[model samples]
Target: MITIIAAIANNHVLGKNNQLIWHLPADLKRFKLTTTGHTVIMGRKTFESLGN
Candidate 1:
């Protein structure tokens, strides 16, 4: 099963300058809990945003 996770704004904005425009603690917790122990996949930009 492949599960893709992302956050899109109402204006269809995904991110800016390789970083998220907003922060939500609950969302973060959910993401962590859901993706934990999974083989996470992400785009190059998203990886860069995490300073990888």
Candidate 2:
């Protein structure tokens, strides 16, 4: 299966300033666990968020 992970802000802003608004360690852990040994999928916009 494919897993998709995304981070959003309180104002429902996705990819603000081309990046996530906040960083949560737990969220990262969950995403890692969920996608472990599995294929991941995302859009170009999502990948671009990694820059900032």
Top candidate by TM-score: 1
User: Over the stretch 1-52, how does candidate 1's per-residue lDDT look in tens digits?
Assistant: 7778889999999888767879998998999899888888888876676663
- Which parts of model 2 are misplaced by more than 4 Å? 1-4, 45-52
TM-scores of the candidates are 0.77, 0.59
Q: Give the runs in model 1 whose Cα sits over 4 Å from its true position.
A: none
- Cα displacement (angstroms), candidate 2, residue 32, comes to 0.7
Whole-model Cα lDDT of every candidate shown, in order: 0.84, 0.71
For candidate 1, the 10 contiguous residues with the lowest summed lDDT are 43-52
Per-candidate Cα RMSD to the true structure, in Å, reads 1.8, 3.5
TM-score of 2: 0.59
- For model 1 the TM-score comes to 0.77
lDDT of 2: 0.71
lDDT of 2 by residue, 1-52 (tens): 4344667667788756756677788987898788778766777986575475
Model 2, total clashes: 0
